[model samples]
Target: MKKLLIASALLAASSIQQAHAWGQTGHRITGAIAEQYLSEEAKAAIAALLPNESLAEASTYADEMRSNPEEFWQKEAGPYHYVTVPKGETYKEHKHAPEQGDAYTALKKFSKIVKDDTAPLSERQRALRFIVHIIGDLHQPLHAGDGTDKGGNDFKLEFFWEKSNLHRVWDSGLLDRRQLSYTEWTEWLSEKITPEQAAKWNTTDPLIYITESATIRDTIYPEGDRLGWDYLYQHLPTAKVRLQEGGVRIAAHLNELFAK
Candidate 1:
């Protein structure tokens, strides 16, 4: 029965092909974004790890990061880790089988691997870089969703004239239609952030981010079958809020990690 639901969900998600790309595109954006924000430690780590490679080579790696990040993880998987319950009880949590491994254990092991001097510089940089991006991804609601639908991937819906799913709406649907580049979006978002919000955003517990994303899952879907600019006008504020929060949280976590 569980397998049937997941299969059905994946089938549903496949019907609207564009939504599936978020997991990939997010990482691509993530890797590209890293070049813009790397700290000296991160830079040194990259330099040492890929001593002979040019920055452009490392930058281009984002292309493949979108293709299949798991391959890159092979050489550099340790630092940014995940945990999945290794057991038959995968039926737990709505049968959300651990896609990676035990997330808690993965986190601990990754933290250790990245901190240890023994880890390769390139590998360390990769792990750190991935952590920077993935943590933000995890906060994006759809990413933390059920395994079957591929995190809202299965739930077919429409936004305005285009047929889309909940995941795609959050991924870029809402943001893209605004006609703002990521940087422009970031800047616009940055401007509205109050000191109060920044202070609150700085605190711990990514679970809040995860929960925030999940809460928004249904909202991303239009009220009825078809939605249009009215929906966008109504929801654009929320979209801005999420994007702003993402940038703030991204910077917050990186600052905490790299703090001397």
Candidate 2:
């Protein structure tokens, strides 16, 4: 029993350490799709800022730095990955403190940094990478949590006969099960986005992203603790839609930022 308890504690710690929106592949997919929509000027500006790194390569930078020993990574930036708007409440009703910024606030903060010509190159690069990442993070429904279950991380379940949590299943399990590389997923989804859909989805408004995800979040909790094919069949379309929207919106934001 002692050994079992030790394993459980280790698992919990690992889960907390690893918590992030949309596993690496999902973030990369959004980044790749966003690249297809960038205006020439936007592309040039991004290339200048990121040099050799494509947006897809930069999209996971923030998450990849979570293990950094800096205070910003270890403590200050933790809440920026998600927001909490309890069921039936809007973000305005539960705005997070500025000192403890959430995704909405962080996006705005990073956007300014990315757009500032006087900002140090290193700072702007970091901000731009984070902007690419946090936009992807905000699209994951669980990231706009309903102020319960720690954005579904606390809601344990079995996914494909393996132990998992709601957040993890949504983060990677559903997308990973399809076994497609991020490029393939980006290609498949980008080809399907209609001009009308792109126009509609291309909004820099973070609130809309958060609200839409929160609304979706309320509907995604399964009726049981076990999830499999049926759940995927029902929710996969929604996940794809979110990824498409995230990519389109990321492009829109970057375009506007660099339009100067």
lDDT of 1 by residue, 1-260 (tens): 99999999866543443332233333334344334445676556556555765332333243245334365434333222222111222213333324444323343344556667887866666555445554545555565554456556567778767887767776767667766555555455556778798667664355566556556654565557666687778876765565456545555555555555
lDDT of 2 by residue, 1-260 (tens): 99999999867765675788889999999999999999999999999999999989999999899878888887687788888888888999976544778888889999999888999999999999999999999999999887668889999999999999999999999999999999999999999999999998989999999999999999999999999999999999999999999999999999999996
Off by over 4 Å in 2: 1-14
Give the Cα lDDT of each candidate: 0.51, 0.91
Candidate 1 worst ten-residue window by lDDT: 78-87
TM-score of 1: 0.66
Q: Which candidate is the best by TM-score?
A: 2
